[model samples]
Target: MRTSPPEPLAAALVEGRTSSLKEPLLRDGRLLWLEQRPQEQGRTTLMLRPAGGDTAVELTPSPHNLRSRVHEYGGGVYAVGGNDLVFVDDSDRCLWHLNLPGAPRRLTTPGPRAFADGLIDGPRRRWLGVMEAEGRDQLVAVPLAGGEPQRLHQPADFCGYAALSPDGRQLAWVEWQQPFMPWQRSQLWLAAVKQDGALEGARPVAGARPVAVAGSGPNATDAETDTYTDTSAISVFQPLWISPTELVVASDASGWWNLQRLDTASGAWQPLLPLEAEFAMPQWVYGMRTTAWDGQQLIAAAAREGAWQLGRVHLTPDRVGTPAAWEPLEQPFDDLAGLSAEAGTLVALASNPTSLEGLLELDLTTGSWRHSPAAPCPLQPEAISQPEPLWFAGHGGVRTHAWFYPPAGGAHAEAPLLVKGHSGPTAMARRGLSLGIQFWTSRGWSVVDVNYGGSTGFGRAYRERLDGQWGVVDVADCAAAAQALVAAGKASAARIAIEGGSAGGFTALAALCFTDVFRAGASRYGVTDPSALASESHRFEARYLDGLIGPWPEARATYEARSPLAHADQIRCPVVFFQGLDDQVVPPEQTERMAAALEANGIPVEVHRFAGEGHGFRSGSVRIQVLEATEAFFRRHFQR
Candidate 1:
C-alpha cells in the first residue's frame, strides 16, 4: 500500500495579508487602534471604527508611521481625548497632533528627544508623557499650542506610566532607577497639580521598599531569627484613579501581582480580590493595562497557571474592610491584553488556541460579547493543531511548563521535533494559534513552545530562576523539554532542532554549544556575546544584564564563559543565522561574528542579512523568505 504525505501549510498563511493590532483604545463610543500592515512595507497606521459602524477607517495616511522609539521596544504610541489625538511620528521621532477633519501638525521641535506613554491634559491644553533625551528619562509636558516641552519631574533614572487623577488635581506615575527593570522594582508616586500645571508635594505612595514579615521570609529556612527580611522590592503596575482621593494598582508584594487600592489622604492600602493569580504582566513597553474601571466595577484580566481570564470586582469606599465580591466572566480567549472600558462597554485584544488574535467586545449590561478578528483564518478548523499543556522537569528538577503541538494529519510513527524558546527570556509561551507554529505541524513536524524557568505568567520566585543564570537555566530547560518529548516516544530523539530569536536565539545557540540534545539550530538576531551586549546596548537595557548575568565588567569572566560565540567550536551541528543590519538591541556584528566562527570551523552555516530591517523582520516578503529558508535548511540537515 502506498501512503501520501500530508499537505503543507502555505507560507502566506503565516506572513502575508495579516495585520497586527495594538494599543486598542475605546473613546467616546469609538474604537481606535494601531494597525501594523506588513504587506504595506510594515507601515503602522491609526484605525478608527465609528460608534455603531462595522467598518474601520484609516486615519493616518501613507508614510505617517505612528510609532515610538523611546525604549527601542516602544508602546503607548497614541493617546486620545474627546476629538483630539496625539501620536509619535516614526519618521522624525517627534510628537504630532491630529484633530478630526484636519491635518496633523508637529508639536515639538525634533532633536534627540523621543516621547511615549502619552496622556492628553485637555483642561490644561498640554500633552503629558515620558520624554527620553540624552540617556535620561523625565516626565514632560508638551503644549498643544506649540512650544518647548516643560520638564515636570525627574524622579529617578527612568519614569513612565503617567496617569492623572479625576478632577485633574493630582498626578500619578511609576518610576524605577538603574540596575532594576520596571517589573522587578518600581514605585508608585503621587503629587498635587498646581494651577499652573507644576507638580507639588510629590511622595511615594507604594513600592518604596521590600516587604518584610516577622519571624519568616518568603523562603525562610532559619528558625532562630525573630525577624526575617525579603530582599526583592515590590513592583507596581498601571495606576488608575477610581475616585478623586483613591486609585487602584497591581503590586507584587504578596508574591503575586494582585490588585490593591490606595487612599492618598490616609496612606493606606486595601486589598482588592487578593487571589493567587497575576493581575499584571512584565512592563516591557509602556501603556500596558490589565485592569480598567467600568464606572460601576473594576474589570480585570488575570493569568492563572499559564492562561488568562477576565473577571470583575465589586468594591466601594463603604466596603473597604469587607472582602470584594468577585465575578468571573466565561469567555473562550486564553490570551488577552490592551483592555479598555467605558460606559459599560469593555474591549480588549484576545485570542485562543483555535483562533487568531482579534478585537473582543463585551457588553456588561447584556452579558454578551462579539469578536472581530484582525484577519480571517485562511485554514479550516480541522487543519489546526491544538496545544496540549505539558509539564516537564526543568533545570535542577524544577517543574516547568510548555505547550506541545503534535503533527497534524500525519501518519509518521515518530515525528521530528522543533523546540522553541520564546523571546524576552521573561516572556511566556502563549497558547494562541500561531500560524508560524502550524506551518511546521501541518508538515508533520511536532513542536514544543517551552516556557523556561524565568518566564512570566508564574509567581515571582519562578520568574527569578534565571536571575544571574541566563544562558545556563534557559539552555537546560529547553533541552529538557525536547528530551521529555523523546522519552514519551512521540518524537524522534535524533531529529530534533531548536530555534529562537533575540534572547531566545541566545538560548538556542547556547544549547547547541553546551548540550547535545538538538541536531541543528537557528538564530535570528541572537545575542552571541553578552559582554558585547553589555557595552553596546541602548539606554533602556544598559543595566538589564546586571540581573540577567551580573554587572558587566565585574562579572566579565562569567559573560565570556557563557557566550556562544566564545565557544563556537563546541557546537557540532549545522546552523543558520538571520540578522537585521540596523538592529540596535542585538547588533548585526553579533550574528556576523558567530557565523564567521562556525564557517571557520568548517561547519555548515547559512547567513541571511537584511539591510533595512531592524531587530524584527516586518516586511511580508522577508518573513516568507525566512520561513522558507529555515524549513529548507532543516530538511537538508536532518536527512544527513
Candidate 2:
C-alpha cells in the first residue's frame, strides 16, 4: 500500500550507472567490502564474505596500496601506507602497520610527507592522528604501543582527532586555530593519564576560560589570584571516550553536530546524545575518526531525517541527568558506504543511487538488522536505474536538493541528458543510491544529483548559499536545476551532457563557462583555477580560496572573471576529461590546460590521464576506464 516512491527520478542530471559505497571493515566473521568499478579501470577491489555469505573473497588483487585514500578504520588492526610503506615483518622498514593478513608490524618513522586519518584504539595503545605537511597541525601519538607521537594540547589551531579512553585513561580531542573551520569554532580537549603513563596536563573540556581562585599569603597570592584565562572556548567535532571519565564529543554547542559529554576529572558536563541531526563529520584523515565503541554504548554516524544513518547512544553507567536518547539504527542512505561499530556487531556499508555497496549487520543486543552482501553490480537488478528526489526552487528562496535517475531498461526512444558536476562545490549530492546514477538511469539516460549552493544538509542558511556565490550561484543552480528539469517534462532538450568530479569538476567547468544548461561537458579532478586554488592549496585549505573566491591578489579580476580556464573562447560544447596523473588536487595541468584550450577552440576536447591517480581515480582499472569511457563518450555525443 505504500507504493508512491517511483515518480521522483524525473530530470535526474546524469546517472548512466553509479553506485559507490565505501570501506567499512570488520574481519574474520567477515564484513569487508570496497567495490568501485568506476567502469572497471578505476577499480577498487576488496571483498570478503561471511556475515550472510555468498562466498565473496577478492581480498585485494592488484591494489597499488589503494589510491584515493582511506587510511584507517579499525584500530584493532588497519594501517595502510603511501609512498613506500610495506610491512609484513619490516620489508620496507615499516612506516605504518596493521593490515593483518600476515601481521606486518611497525607504525611510524620516516616523517615528512604526512596526511593520515582513521585510527584510535587506545588501551594497549594506538592513536595515530598525524597531519603535518605543514598539515595545519594535529599530531598525537601512541602511533603503535610505542612512543614518540604524543603532542596534543595545541589549540591556537588544529590539533588532530585523538579520542582514546575505553580505559586508556583519557584524551578526547579537537582544536582549531587561525581563521576557524572545524565548523568555525573548536577546542574540545581533555587529557589525564598518570598512573605512570604521562600526559596529565591538557585543557579546555569544551572551551572555557575563567580560572583564578587563590587565597594564600606566604606566596603573596589571591589578588584575584592574578587569574583570568578564557581563550574564547568554542569546541565542536567527534570527541568520544564515553566513560572512564566520560566523554562523547561532536558539538555545535547545540546548533547541530550533536553528541556532547564532558567530565575529565570533573569540569563536568553531559548530553551524550540529543539530536535534531548531524552526528559526525571529517572523513578520510584516516577514515573512522570517532564513533564506534561498545563499553556501554556509542554508535554515531549521522545526517538525520534527510538520510545517512547509524545513530544509537545508550551509555548507562551510574546514570546521571539526560544522556540524550537518539535511536535510528541505520537505514536511509543512498550512500553511507562504510562504517564499523563494535561491542557485538553494527557494520553497514550501504549504497543505492544504482547499487554496489553491500554489507550490514546491526545487532547490538537485539535492535535487530541484517542486510549483508547484495551490492556487487555490473548491472542487473533489472539493470538497476532508480534515484529520484528533486525538490527545487533554489536561488535563495531556498528549497534545493537533488537526485534523479532515469535510464535503466527503457530505450528512451531518444535518451540523452547527463548533467552532474558534483564534487562538493561544499559537497552534497546525496540521496545515497547510485551506481554511477544507475549507469545513467539503467540505460535510457538521465540523471541529476545537484545539491548545489554550498550543500550540507540544508542549514546554516542554505549552507551559505554558495558563500560569495562561487562561480555565480553554483553555475546558476546547476543551470537552474537543468532548466527546471527540462521545463518539467524531465529532460531531452537536444539531450544534455555534463559530468563532474573534484568540486563537481568545478561545477562542470562553471557550466561550460556560464550556462546554456549544458550542451556537453566532463571534468574529473576539476577546478579551472580559482587563482590556482589560491596559489596552490594544502594547509587544510590555506584560506580556502578566501572563502571560495575573494582575497587573492584582491580577487584578481574576480578570479580571472570566474575562470572556466578563463573562458576558452566561450566554449561551444564537446569536452571530455578524466585526470589524476597524480593530481595535487586538480592538477593534471588543470586538465591539460583545459584540453589545450578546448582543442584550440574548435571545441571537442579530450584528456584522460591516470598514471597513479591522485585527486581522484583509484583504480578498479581506472574506475572501469572512467565508466567505459564515459559511456562511450555519451554514446558518441548522443549519436551526433
Best by lDDT: 1
lDDT of 2 at 21: 41
Each candidate structure's TM-score, on Cα atoms with residue i matched to residue i, is 0.95, 0.33
Put down candidate 1 lDDT per residue, 494-560, tens digits, no spaces.
8999999999999999999999999999999999999999998998899999999999899999999
**What lDDT does each candidate get?**
0.87, 0.59
Model 1 lDDT at residue 454: 89
Best by TM-score: 1
Where is model 1 more than 4 Å wrong at Cα?
A: 1-6, 209-232, 316-320, 410-413
